[model samples]
Target: MVRNYKRKTDWTEKSKKAVKNGQTIRQAAHNYGINESSLWRAVRNVSAGKSLVSLSEASQSRIIFFLEEEAVLVEYLLKASRIGFPLDTSTLKSLAYDLAIRNSKRSWRTQKSAGKDWLKGFKSRHSQLSIRTPEPTSIARATAFNKTNVGPFFDKLKQLYEELSLTPERIYNVDETGGS
Candidate 1:
């Protein structure tokens, strides 16, 4: 379920400023109607030299990849998809795992691959990509309409028409060849 939590950046900044200017955490949180711990964290972040906007925009959970790294990954995924070799979720996870391993990510030590939660988050972050089951195609059907078969069939059709001296009006397509 999605939370309807709206961040009051203006009020948060005001609360943080109040805390910085000698107001207690409880008083600031109560005055701003924000969580006391959250206000404390915000004040701490401000003291640590992070801007209020960055504090407000920061995600609660740590992202596995940086923005530029994710951008490169997104580009590769799109290019592969356009070239008719789209990656499935499992393959994507494996690739992510390999990337993490290459980058020496400590958290990925115990896991074989990136988790489903990571895939969910990745999909949410990148709106352009969507998961879908591709329509199945039989090998015979796919290979049946090639130039080798189509050229001869059309040639035979032209020959039959010429031999029979058939006019355009004489041609008719019938669905049923059976009659009662």
Candidate 2:
């Protein structure tokens, strides 16, 4: 079951605006309808260069990695995915450990690898990416299907179709022979 709640104010945005205008945390809290303590914390974080929006909206649960570090990891993951070399969870954790070591994140140095909780947070933060079971196929088979055969076939088929001025609605490509 899902519960929907209406927000009375975007306290973060209001707090930021108030701080920028030289209002005290207490004044900002009263003006923006945010808890005084939470607004004070938000002011402190904002003073430290963390965005109020992210502070307010992001999950309050413990996070092992910093935002910039996680962003870099996400970039690597996206690039790997584009190159058809997406990492599984264990591999991603290992990579994250390596990243932490390279970036000299002192807290993470004590751990062997990022925990399952960290992985869950990372996944939730990145909604566009999904964990999927890979199809059962050899690397050689997949390479051949994608690089050796499929590309040339599509290129030639496209050339011939354009030469014949085939209408998209009427034209269909179907394999005539089932796999032996």
Candidate 3:
């Protein structure tokens, strides 16, 4: 009884080492060129609940927190960008992106939500955070503090009026005492 064998995708030395060192399947896939879902399955085949259970308590918690935050942030950014929000990625990874060929493989589904269905499961966690921070109309007018000409200068004037809205003389007093 001869059975046709599937050619094994050569796992790199680094991937083997990572697996030995108890790195997650996804980590091995990322560190090497292995498929994430495939790597997970191969690891699972070797030992049931072995790799998953070996995860350090701190590391597991960290990943859960990180994923929760990432899901929320992704939704926030996509919505904000659609309606035209600030284009700053000050907190971005600040690294160049590379593409990974995704595998259609999946892990054994535990008694838990999986696949695209789990994508927004933690979205309600982010709903607690207020994305729309309304700037005070007065202070928001004076965006550029150092500009000497036109736009910013005019804004300063507007700011001054709001500041002294209740004062009688209400002079901006922009002209500081001449440089002594």
Candidate 4:
């Protein structure tokens, strides 16, 4: 659920300044069209030595990783997907659990893995990541077809053909697929 507050950051700052400049909290809040309670809290925070510029909106307390950490995680997921090794939901959850453990975050209810709610929240935060059923592929087929292996195989085949002085007419092509 998103909160559509009527007051912007400048408005809150103006209200706080007005209260500081002898205007009553009610008058400042009414003039700026901000909630009185919120304005009061802002004023209180200012009085308590918190800088006015530092009084920005707070993030959710339940977030396990910092913004930068989450960004790194998102990048890792993207790289993994680009490499034809996209992680499933369970694997993602397990990874999240491992991350939390490594970071010493023990606030989660489930010790084994991240909960479904966390995954849902993670997906919502990172719109680029979507859950999809990946097509089943054989391990050999997936691993053997990459450029690092194919390039060398072709180079070796060329060297072999050159060493044998093979001619195009004497060469035979084999079709493993049994197609005409």
Candidate 5:
């Protein structure tokens, strides 16, 4: 297969190293096999205290959310997952649109929802996260009460109850099929 993707951080460190060693941008570019224009831009950005890794070149001009905005979205998704209300891609896209609107972003105001390309980039950027389909359970496995897992679970629950002195009114259960 022909390799079409540009390596995002390919010359980030090497370019920085060469510049720090007092080499010119052209010299760094030649030594590191990076485009001279790219090296020049990186050097300017580095001098201005910007990140050495070029987000624009890394994303190949497809990025919408800035690094900070993306970080906020990531934190929101993670928090939702921890609380057991994971958002699917469609909902996430809608939420992104909403967030952009609420933040008064003029550029994103034209978009109804985040596009598939944006979603693809988002997933690629967060490749460490695993998105998987839940396995279908057998009726026997579902019905069979597994004492090993359940016993400790309830024990922890009881422990929490005692520690917190929780009332019955404070406890509420949520299931997957329940309506919002």
Candidate 6:
């Protein structure tokens, strides 16, 4: 019951179903009510250029363990870690973070990752670009500035700022040295 360029969610669901049915992307789009370009985008987004995930021994074991766990904490931790949440914290800390993160927005940037299949195919056939390396980028400089070194620089600045002042103890430093 799909119509062309209808609701986005409807399109996605129909597209996903069509793909699952072993239809080629163009064929899938044709039957499921979308254009070739739209179908390509959906397929590319889900597959991420490489083949779809298949169940393997390791995957099966992981699934079994995840299902058998007393709490879903391990599964929760795994999902959280993938999205850049801290999973190494103590139980209480983990719980706190888990609770706090419920309202945080999910990052949509993963789709824009270079491995998208449509992008890969398009670039390969037309632009001759690979996901790992696009066009020629800037050559690496031997002494490129690293943002990671900025913390120490700021600490030194704080020291310098404090040193130039008459009172050091009274100076309220907002940042703790090497703040975690």
Candidate of highest lDDT: 4
In candidate 6, stretches whose alpha carbon ends up further than 4 angstroms from where it belongs are 1-9, 49-180
Model 1 lDDT per residue over 1-180, tens place? 223367456777788788878999999999988899988878888789885654335654556788887887788888887676778888888888888777777556677888877888788889888655455789999989799979998899899999999888877555442211
Give lDDT tens digits, candidate 2, residues 78-106: 78876767678888888988987788765
lDDT per residue as tens, model 6, 77-139: 545544545333233233423433452423223432222332333224333211132233355
lDDT string for model 5 (60-136, tens) is 55446688988998898878776766778878888888877777765455668977776776777898544344356
Give the whole-model CA lDDT for all candidates, comma-separated.
0.77, 0.73, 0.47, 0.78, 0.74, 0.47
Give one digit per residue, the lDDT tens place, for model 3 in 54-88.
32553354232345445545665656645646223
Against the correct fold, how does model 3 do in TM-score? 0.21
Report how far residue 50 has shifted in candidate 1, in Å.
10
Pairwise lDDT winner, candidates 2 and 6:
2
- Residue 96 in candidate 6, Cα distance off native in Å: 37
Tens-digit lDDT track of model 4 for 14-114: 78878878999999999988899989988898789886443233435567889887888889898887665888888888888888888888855456888
Per-candidate TM equals 0.51, 0.46, 0.21, 0.50, 0.44, 0.23
Candidates ranked, most accurate by TM-score first: 1, 4, 2, 5, 6, 3
Q: After best superposition, candidate 3 residue 74: deviation in angstroms?
A: 65
TM-score of structure candidate 2: 0.46
lDDT of 3: 0.47
Clashes of 1: 0
Between prediction 2 and prediction 3, which has the larger lDDT?
2
What value of lDDT does candidate 5 attain over all alpha carbons? 0.74
TM-score, prediction 1: 0.51
